[model samples]
Target: MAPAGSAACVFCRIVAGEAPAYRVHEDGAVVAFLDQRPLFPGHTLVVPRTHLETLTDLPEESVGPYFTAVRRLTGAVERAMEADGSLVAGNNRVSQSVPHLHTHVVPRRRKDGLRGFFWPRGHYADETEARRIAARIRAQL
Candidate 1:
């Protein structure tokens, strides 16, 4: 059965074989497939078999094995695409379009004309605010 709260999730449906995906690789814990809206031709998404909305939600025990699959897929993507390098990234809740935890492995080539980030960087309003944010994160840690 699909995990709780996973019925509406597209990735979960794909995992359940209720939807179609151009799957590239899959193991007990994770699956890798081509991105529907790809950054490049060979862009792929690696997702956990279980439905977890974000990295923070993933069980600590699952992290190493999950990333092992990611690492393997990264190497495979680079080799298969003949890319000079690859960009591997995961969005938390902020910019994540899908609720499921997944990593983007995009093949990159030199002079491909892709800029640094899709969004613009912003400066902290002031040093006080910056330190406050840092302190909050430090406290959580």
Candidate 2:
């Protein structure tokens, strides 16, 4: 994992594979992976290959490809999970987790029973449990 206090600056190390992650999708410009701590079942994150701190740091041309990936992944998640719809989001203010520019593609369903994810997060109880969850996501990836 990245060193501590990285929450403020950005999480480039995680993106670069300098740190461990259950990486799923990768290409020339973007890397997508399942969220280690997901809000929903098929939650995934898409970030640029370059190390930019925020959305404003991205070039004008970069937005199209990024969103294109997001759009494509939205379909992938929906088809894979058989969901009703999907949630595509970027970190403008409230949804920001890692400072590096990335988009979240969350598959949504009707009876899956989730209100929303605009709230606090609970900590995992132990490493064993976290590992199990990570393993499952890795399989899907």
Candidate 3:
């Protein structure tokens, strides 16, 4: 169900076809579209079809599927934009200008000059190494 105040939300209007968007993909639960003010070309935002004020507001059952769409779009964006990788991020409340739960999948290339957010990024040496890290998280979960 759409949250209260969705009618005033720009993203909600876009989802409802009341606003314009360069749509990339849409499913029963989510929509992917190009950001009008992209961090880089091919930067896309994946949002739930239902109105949600933030990630914390999204129903727990929808979390996995929402991120699944994000994961799929991340790969597509990278391939379509010829990017080396992608930077996937979401703001809960503080940096969330839209107030709707959305994920940013920004195409990235090495040494693209994006830096200094206090969080340093690194890569796993290979799939095996990455899997090990995943296992650690799974263990905790």
Question: Best TM-score goes to which candidate?
Answer: 1
Ranking by TM-score: 1, 3, 2
Q: Please, what are the lDDT tens digits per residue for candidate 1 over residues 28-118? A: 9998899999999899999998999899998999999999999999999999999999999999989999889999999999989888788
Prediction 2 TM-score vs. true: 0.69
User: All models: lDDT?
Assistant: 0.92, 0.77, 0.89
Tens digit of lDDT per residue, candidate 2, span 38-134?
8787898888877675687878898888878888888998898888998887776455676577788888988767766667879889999999999
Model 1 worst lDDT window (10 residues): 1-10
lDDT of 3 by residue, 9-108 (tens): 8888888888899999999779899999998999999999888878878898999889899999999999999999989999988878888889999999
Name the regions of candidate 1 deviating beyond 4 angstroms.
1-5, 122-135
Relative to the true structure, candidate 3 reaches a TM of 0.79
RMSD to the hidden true structure, all candidates: 2.5, 14.9, 6.3
RMSD of 1: 2.5
